[model samples]
Target: MPVILPTSIINILSNLFCILINISLFYLYTFKIFYSFQENEISISLQIIGIIVNFQEILLRFFVGYYDKGEIIQDKQLILLNTLNFNFFYDLFYLATLILSQIIMYNQKNSSNLVVYFLNLIYFLKAISVNKILNKVDQLLYITAKADYIYQLLKLIFKLIIICHIVAVAWHLLAQIETNYFEKNNTWLHDLNLVDSQWYSRYIESFYWSTTTIIILAGPKGSNNIEIIFQSVIMFATMGTFAYTMNCIGVILDEQNRKQKEYKRDLEIINIYMRKNNLKKSLQQKVSNFLEYLYQEKGDIQVNKNSIEVLNKLPQNLKDDINVEINSKIIQKFKLISTNFSQKIIQEVIPFIQEECFLPNEIIYKHYQYDNLAIYWISKGKVQIEHQQENAKIVLVKVLEKGDCFSEYQFFTGKQHEYQTRSADFTTIYKIQRDKFIQTIQKYADDYEYFNMIKDQLIFRNGSIYTNIQCLICKSRYHRENECEQIHINKNKQLTILKHLRNQIQISRKPFFRKCFYFIKTIQLIKSCELCVNQIKNNQELFNLIKYIDINNNSMDLDQSLSDNYIQDKVIKNRDNSNSSLSSTSIENNVNDICKQTLKNFKNSIIINSEQINSNDNFKHSQGNKNQLEIKKELQNINLLTCIIFINIQIKRQTDQQLKKQAQIQIRIQKKQIFKNQSIQKKKKKFLQKKNLKQENPQKKYNYLFKIKQTKKNTQVIITQQKKKLVI
Candidate 1:
């Protein structure tokens, strides 16, 4: 009969078995208690944390791995650490799997990964926060792509099956413990009375009492005791079942996936053909599609992915894509995508081309003009291109300083056209004729290497970048597609500026050469100023502004608005704010006495509006001349109003001296007409201001206009006056 072991003896044996198993797994730890063990090693720290996290990751991935993503090929090196210092296959598999499991659960590391690895592996002397760790954790999310699911699932199942089987074996191993290795003992082998007389004493293996019947399965088949025979059959069947299951699983995982592999091979073949054929669209689309497929298939729990992790670090391709689109549009607009040409160079370049002489207000080009070249480089100065609108003038573009080019396309394409061109300031341009440009490009492609890049970037080669800036300010980006400014610069404007400088030269009584030089410099400066550029939207207004400059006067310190193109003049105290003053005392009395003597020699400047302003409602709004003298009126009447109103507005608007001069011209014409009247001639001609003119009393020391007389012409007037009152 079989003997049953005591409960006390069974527990003592089980406890001893548990200790032996623990000692085998963590033998080094037996040297010290868990608390006393050194926790300094980074790898060890990571391993300990990994022990807990590995199981968690396996569970998390199991639910989603198979159908969620595709297979990923990874480097085997990162997993090599688990294969270290191991003999048994099961132990090596378990350790390797623990590391693999964690890596698969997490996403691939990034630049932040170095921080995470160090933190996880080593306990830092300094403190760190959980949030810091969480941040590192977040970076891993990107690498856990959908494609790595197959590997993740297979890996999880393999680990789980092996671990469960090991546990069962461990329990079974514990159940058959015997105190003595050499002496005879009744082990679990006799529980069902299957052990023969020599079963325990014989040198046999397989974790059961060795018997010839058990090893050969011949004597063991005797069924005299049916219960013992049944027990033997059951144990044998159980052992065979577990072994077969493990083998089957290992084989299934090792099999090749022919379908996925075939698809990849076919895709590569198509991509290679597209590249060889130079099919741009097809090639680009294929590349993009292939990239999408790779990411979709290869990145689940996909932690610490080798090469794939670096892909996210690549420079973004979106901007390059946008540039491609822009370049495409630019190319589409061209009449010829690629052309070869030749040119004959001429030695005698136009003086205007060499000297590049331009005043600030000089018109550089006109609209509807054609040239064949596509490149224009700015050599010096600034330029503005403007457009005409229904209600007002709009700035189309602006270019400043050197190296700006405009309208090189006209010379190259063999198109004859007319367009208005203006200089934002006196500017120099290196003009290249299209024929010459084509010949040069054909001869020296290296110098114009940027041509292709520009084409690729889609920047237009024709328009000046400065003109574009002005246009941007005046109109929204949408309005650029409409008609650009190409109106003719009126001759009247050139003459107006010329006359002002001519008058100044006359007043100085300087030599012809000196006067001409002075005029050029003054005109150039004013032309470059913001006050002129911003207000000179159209040709007519520029003409009037030129007319308004007082040639006889010398004060020309530019206000900021004029220099900077600002609309508002913050300097120059407004009359509204200038009213406050101090009570006059002895010093003021002395000043008044001096002023009384010279006051008689002064004459007020008659300011005028620009002719363009007079024609437009915007100018009317500006003038506060609400009562429309809008119709052509006596220049004298308008002159007085413009002068007074000019003082109240921004200094950059310019004094309307020119428009007031126009009014004076009309007044003189009227006077001439009156003189021509048959009976009116008989009477002494009467001046309009004669009645209001202050009489020079013999006792009065002061003569405000001692020698000044207002001489009238056709709506124009001139007063001989001292320079002091007119200037400051």
Candidate 2:
């Protein structure tokens, strides 16, 4: 098991032993006259005590657990190693030397005093280490106490005493050492006529000299060079010690007067502000009186505000408990809350119960004020409610003291205040807004219903029935402004109003610029639409088909309608001339085929134009250059002819698909027959041209034509021979 010693007791005992050791060492060794073996009973007694204390400490090093980096080490091996590493060997050496010196003094009466001096020196060194340990213990005690000033003063006094004792012993030692160089009578001790004085008297004189020199720099002058040098060194060391002592005292006094200093600073700032604003003396006095009262009542304004912020950072449950502790009495005073609400509901409302302070006669709320729609509970001081009679006389209604509530009926009724409320004195009140209270209770269904019922009862008792609340914006009784139907309508109306304003501004501008801009935009749109239409019209075959469809179907009028009609008339006349060759069904089939092809081409053109317009819109949107409104206006200005064509295409798209398929098949067959007929007609034309050339130049032209025919026949015969060889 580890041995545990009370550190406080150990520290006290150690300090006592250290003082005894220092006194014995200084007197017995430094004076030398008191070093007689027979007369050193006091010194020997101290040495015996020192031996016991040192032995106890050595045992403690091994048995008692010591702090290693804040944790206590109790393992025997580790504790033994730790003890051996620090001061254990040195302590053992000192103990051995002390024991040897004691043994020598007892057995050998004529032994040298050098051994006693060495033993005293070792004991003094051990005492110095004990002083350091005591200092650490003092610091620990000081940290655990509240009286910092007292602890510091005590510590300073103790250090001064120790320094004086050490210096006194050294000063006498220096004087004794100087006797080696010169006669003993020539030293400072002899100059003071005290060389043969008793050891106690000599020690007292040395201590008095050290104290005076160190504290006040007032002491006898040195008689020799050694004495002068020692005195000068002591003076320098004391200068710094004195400065540090004064500094510590100053810090203590400053801490004690910190509050007063802050108060003065605040007052100075207020005075400067008043002077800069040039306030009247009477008003300034009133302000000063208020400030005095504020400071007396509240020690520091910033401290209170900082405390509130600190409280807000606490956990919610902890804050709730604190709030309950602060306002439980005030909450119990409210009959409506205490009787009707559950504990949980009361806790929920506590967070929103804000505390407000008011000065004497400060108007908290005026009569019929819409903003004062919250319940007030007086937590401190008094409140006075004043009502104005119909005869224009102000009457004091009642004086409300602590725990009294006002405006409870108004809070539930959602009505304006009927009386003015003012603070009767320096008052503190807790306010709970009606909306926050309702919102908190809403989480509990039963509590919310009960609250509403109480609110209705309160309103009825005041001779006013609860009615539906109308929307503030639209005056609709069914819903609030946020839920009103007119909100979207109002938004659209705002847009229209902005548009009208813009149009009015444009009308006020120069018409020439506006007209030019509109004309340019229209021209650009027309050009784009015409470009798309012209691409379809540039196809000669599709254009011809369009003309035929326009002539036969007469579905809609077009730019080429007159020409188409004229061409149709000529074709009809030719058909009339060859009425026997062509039947009516063939004419109708041809017309139908032409119409189908035209409609297909029109649909494809419309699709391409639509795709291009959509792509342009996407590009403009990506570039963010043109807004949606501008794009819409440009689309609206498209050519009217394209609109009509699109309408006609849609109507034709609804036609029977079987007729279109049949027409397509007939058209393909007729195209092949026409191609064959054209080829045969070209051959006949070539033969006719050859006959004409032969008639014009009989010999040479006819031989040229015959040679061309012969070359064609030879090429055909060579192609047949190559085919026959491949077959073989």
Candidate 3:
């Protein structure tokens, strides 16, 4: 028969087992799981707290171990002393025992009625809280760090606990079954008499015993060697489980710590950058708040922590896959993209689509600003579009929610925004920058249609209604309803005016042309007339001689008839050759009169020539007398030159004597000046040497040299001045 343990003993051992289990898993729950989630200074404090918490459990376990011993440890003082050595609140008890007990109870290590239950409840609460914290940490780590080891370990731990419970239940049920079978066969195994009414009682008893045996190191007072071996095996298995869990927790902690540190470092770098840039307090606060919001939203999600950096670092294929997956929803939600694009085009644009986050009331873009280079599609939260007036008043035009987009219309059209868009709350959006959009679209042939559709849609929406109905030409609205006032001339009127102007110009030009033509003709006529007159004048002598002969012989009519006949022939020929307005008869008449005049003039000139010739002879005789007088004057000038030459020779003798004496005096003065300059230079050199011997003062030496140079310069100037005076 198996020996059965006392109920009191079993209860104490069960509690002891629970405490051991809690102690073994304390680090795994608190430090490895919970504290590891934080990548900040707070995490360090948490880790310290975890260490303290785990130590508390261990201390309780120590107390239980010592308490499990027999009455030999009955001395309360000894028990207290031993506990105090390992306790965190050992110093608190020195002042008062009352305070000490209260502290011990508060610390969950009091020895009093229901103390064990209280400790049990405390351990259970700790375990539950730790577990919850661990779950949260695991979720964070899974998202941001994308760790698999911790997840696998967590699953394994849960499975192991279930298996442990199952194994314990099965073992206890087997023992109970064996006992029942023996008793039913009326055999003496342990006189186990089981009835239908006691089934619940029996089940509870088995479960309790199994739990105690599997968990507690101390075996139940029992029993066959087989039962002892079973308990011992479970004990050994639990220790192995503890060891495995510890090792797994160590690895998880290390990985978590590494990621936490990196996150912390990045945040610290951002803060440092803000401080270094002398950012405004308000701006700094905004940045800090935004970062905190991001942390809260993503909470260590893989797409939050270094995800962008990772994507940048990834191979092309993997990068595209990730980007497409992340941004596919964002693209699909956009009305323009979904309606006009193909799957292929969407995939092509995925690379250009970047996720952006903004805080509440954050300005995404300003009204009527052309500087924005990207289109924003809201994936979460609402955006407010405000129209800003010229007077700086803001009017809320529209409120856009999920699946709605902003900036795309103006962004694509390359026009200024009609309204400003701001985040109504913490917002997540997908944006495609201008350069990236163009680059991506260009790579895919199908994307052109999609891009065109977007452009067309934007154009339609933006131009759907004319905000201001002012005329484009005159900028007037009320005077002309939806139309511009026409101030420009019609085409027909313009052509008529131009033609009229041309006609007027032609009419005005007629007089000028006529005048020019008449003047040219008049010049030609005058030239021809002059030529004819010249020809007539050249034959004047012959004509005049004929006239004179006729007059003297009393046959003037005969001579006139001959002269007129000759003049008529010459004038007729001149008139025939020239295109001037002259008649042959007129020319003949004028020539006849001119011939009579020339005959009279010739008679008078002949008489005048004879008188002038006599006067010229008398003038020549006077000029001959004047030539004789000029010869006599040249003879006097020759005599004066000889006397002047004698005086010049006497003056040259006196100047030559004076020049010789001056040259001798200048030579002597030059020699003396040279000797004096040489002596001065020697004195200067001696002075420099003496100054050098006295002390090596560069300043003094420079001053001395400067004084000497000045003196020499002055002396040279004086000498030159004196020499110049003498020369003069």
Best lDDT among the predictions, by candidate number: 2
Q: Per-residue CA lDDT of candidate 3, range 163-270, in tens?
A: 454454445444555556643332112424433324344444544654565456454544565555666766777767656766777877787677557567767888
**Listing every candidate in turn, what is its Cα RMSD in Å to the true structure after a full C-alpha superposition?**
37.7, 35.4, 32.5
Per-candidate TM-scores read: 0.18, 0.37, 0.33
Candidate 1, 343-425: lDDT as tens digits: 11121111112223455567766556554333345655677756555575655544455654455334433444333457765
Q: Which residue runs of candidate 1 sit more than 4 Å off their true CA positions? A: 1-147, 154-478, 482-728
Q: What would the TM-score be for candidate 3 when compared with the true structure? A: 0.33
Q: Candidate 3: how many backbone clashes?
A: 5
**CA-lDDT, candidates in order:** 0.39, 0.68, 0.55
Candidate 3, residue 505: Cα displacement in angstroms equals 48
Among these predictions, the greatest TM-score belongs to 2
Please give the lDDT score at residue 478 for candidate 2: 46
What range of 10 consecutive residues in model 2 has the weakest lDDT sum?
461-470
Local lDDT at 569 for model 1: 21
Pick by TM-score: 1 or 2, better one: 2
